[model samples]
Target: MPICTATLALGSVSGSLLFSNTDIASSNLHSSSVSSLLSPVSNFSKHSQRYCCSSRRTPWVCSANKVTSNTEINGQTSPVLQDSSVPPTEAVRQARRSADWEAARSYRDSGFICEGRIEGFNGGGLLVRFHSLVGFLPFPQLSPSHFCKEPTKSLQEIAKGLTGSLISVKVIQAHEESRKLIFSEKEAEWSKFSGKIKVGDILEARVGSVEDYGAFVHLRFPDGLYHLTGLVHVSEVSWDLVQDVRDVLTEGDEVKVKIISIHREKSRITLSIRQLEEDPLLETLEKVIPQDGSVGSDSESISDASNIEPLPGLETILEELLQEDGIIDVRICRQGFEKRVVSQDLQLWLSNAPPINQNFTLLARAGRQVQEIQLTTSLDQEGIKKALQRVLERVP
Candidate 1:
């Protein structure tokens, strides 16, 4: 009897082949002909090499329909049989895990971007299942569009409407040992503008909110329509002292700021309101304070002002200068334990006022000089009286 050779395409395994007919020549089945039978398994593994399938010991049965051609597997020609009852082998499961882990790493390093459907909320963030893995997207890592501002609503309650929403995300952290995967929709969103923003760039911004430490500004760039949030630290708010951010800034206030720093790793943009304006104190000092070749030619006199005693009757000279001009320029000569000595056009104003730690310049007469001028409340009459009394007492 002339024998017929048949090939079976199994439901699960990729490379396994079942050949039954003994009389037919193997040469007759060309590898090209069996490509159709391998379609199911090839399609399953296109995303990642990791795949799982049944590893049952039961023999796979071939139906009356037979595969007429040969198939390729791992560079060699091979083939499958359908086994309905078998489960995947332990070896297969491990291989699948290994492949999945490798895929996760690729996604992390290469920034494999993907979109996930929001399944639920974990009270602090959204839970999303993506690519056969479940990852947590923390609230802080969520895009501003999805963030809830309503204080009365719970995160889950506020996110209830987002249960079916699809969000674009990137895998940030992935660990197979702990089965932990972290995703950030915010990062994915910011990638669009990463190339556009740069340090020293000026942005027209609106105050988003004021915090104790700083204020967040919604930065507007001319090239992009999206608004990025940049932080303006309290110290960067203005040239003048700021006791409270709320005092200097309020929500929705439109202002211009300069980008001082960009932290790409953290996705943080640091802004400065002060940078947008020239520093008044420094600018004034540069203009009035004589440099090396100027009127104050003696560089040694400008040397460390620490050891130099207040010129004999220096306080008297300062009071005289203050009286003449109504306001004398005080150059910070040096600060000591309990006193600070300042110079006005080469003259000294040594006062027992508690030493001033900050670099400051003020236009003021003797009446405004205080022993310890409070930066925030320098206009206080009583504080100036105390300082003037101390200076006058030193003269006589």
Candidate 2:
């Protein structure tokens, strides 16, 4: 047989096959002869296929492996064998740390420390001063347990008292461009008071501010923070007319109050100074004296008698006229007639009284008088007299 040469293109190798007539006739002599030659060559190609290896990207491969098998490539399996031992990239690790640091810095920069002092105000809000800059303490933020309900006058008084007091406060915020520091005495007090206070507790406080309608009292037990300041309304402070809050209370006036409400999370306190005093209605009722004088006597008359009873004689007839309509203790006077009636129906009765004759005049105790009523001569005097008598008979 002639010599036959087969050049295989395995990996980068490229060639062709050359076979003589004698070699073909020999390979075709039997099926097993053809298989033996082809099987050995196919097995060698599978084992000798070379794979390029790379460590920089994913799916690292080894060049020693002639048989190619696919592994991770572009995050998926490739048609070549690869190394599975490569570690994560350094850039990814650095990016994660950078993200963590940025998150921390953002959290740090979101908070700040501010400083301010209590300034004068009247009812609207507390004025705070910081290095010639001004801020506001809304009524809601003025105290830990007490909120000023009607703050108009109270703020004014508080502003007056805070004028010279050196106060320390927390920075709620800072207006950098304005150079304004928003401070909160309430917030500082809340840090200490949130744990101690509850609703319905009575507290002793000082009057830090007063207004036409109310007063702000600094609580003693809760510390000297303005957040613990209790409010005493003008109506709550006294039963008398409160033309001005300054009349009854001044700054630094120590007083007692009650805690009406508390908002812990919001750090709000609602206090009442009036709760320390007796209710005005109850007090006045307790002091009221029982009636003791005769119903028709001078002592029984109102202190002002311009509307009191007329002469006793006229009172008898007036009582008769009033009795017809369930009126009692009827009193006739020059200025006006007065009586206590069960119903308003007595007005009609007064409009129908018999006209007076001869302009007669009469006097009664408490310096009241009964003037004459104009009448017609033809009117029946005896019938009118009988009508009066009949009306009196129906009264108890």
Per-residue C-alpha lDDT of model 1 across residues 1-396, encoded as one tens digit per residue: 111111122121224222212201332434554342223212122211122221112232445654333333324443332222222232232343455455667777887576766655644566665543445677666654433234345556767767766777777877676556677776776676666889989878778769988998877657433336789998788765555899999976878999999998888999999877776544423333333323222112222344434434444645543443223344334312212233332222222224344322232212212121122223232344334445555555
Give me the runs in candidate 2 sitting further than 4 Å from their true place: 1-171, 174-185, 222-227, 263-268, 284-396
Q: What tens digits encode model 2's per-residue C-alpha lDDT throughout 115-163?
A: 3444344344454543323444554455533323223444455556565
RMSD of each: 17.2, 32.7
TM-scores for candidates 1 onward, in order: 0.49, 0.32
Candidate 1, residue 261: Cα displacement in angstroms equals 2.2
User: How many Å off is the CA of 107 in candidate 2?
Assistant: 7.7
Worst 10 residues of 1 by lDDT: 1-10
How much RMSD separates candidate 1 from the native structure? 17.2
Clashing residue pairs, backbone N/CA/C < 3 A, model 1: 10-80, 10-81, 16-79, 17-79, 353-371, 371-387
Candidate 2: deviation at residue 382, Å? 56
lDDT of each: 0.51, 0.41
